[model samples]
Target: MAFTCTIPAVATLQQDDEAIRITRWDFEPGAVTGWHSHGWPYFVVMLVDGTLRIHDGEKATDVPLVQGQAYMRQAGIQHDVMNGSPHPIAFIEIEVKQPAALKQLAA
Candidate 1:
């Protein structure tokens, strides 16, 4: 079954520029960000210790997160992020923009 949020996750735009886009997500119990894909590489900084369920279409994985923990994911990851905990959880997402020079260097 596809995951749907009864109450959508709250996203606060922290910054948006040519370099990157920063957003803070607040998820209440059973809240979900819905199915989506990242266009660019991004990093996540956990603001609270809680359990999050990440569904990558085929399966769902429960990830235990701790406050201040951070991780990075490459572009094109399609998934739904859900708050699996009973309490509220939050995280900061920073999307990395590849500058023209950086893209060329990677080639």
Candidate 2:
């Protein structure tokens, strides 16, 4: 299924030579990120309290977000995230890129 809502990247807070990228995403009601995969480990910090539906191809899960709450995930996760609330929602995502060998060594 294709997502048609307009989910925009409201801001790019930072990007460094060390391969770190920080971006802020704003989602209006019913907006979605569409299908995407992360190539590096990343973390998300919730800027507004809201609910999101995570669709992983076959199933969908609703996740509640609290303002100031944060979560981390390793690379290779693919999903389409959609705002499940009537109000606007926003969050900051920080991506950390590391050498594959270093990532394997740390595992």
How many steric clashes between backbone atoms does each model show? 0, 0
Query: Residue-wise lDDT of candidate 2 within 1-107, one digit each (tens)?
Result: 53556664255576645767788888888888888999999999999999988888888888998999999999999988888888999999988886443344444
Q: Assess candidate 1 and give its lDDT.
A: 0.89
- Candidate 2, residue 56: Cα displacement in angstroms equals 0.3
Q: What is the C-alpha lDDT of each candidate?
A: 0.89, 0.81
List, residue by residue over 20-99, the lDDT tens digit for candidate 1. Answer: 88999999999999889899899999999989899888888999999999999999999998999999999999998864
- Specify the poorest-scoring 10-residue window by lDDT in model 1: 98-107
**What is the clash tally of candidate 1?**
0
Please identify model 1 stretches exceeding 4 Å from their true place: 99-107
Q: Point to the candidate with the largest TM-score.
A: 1
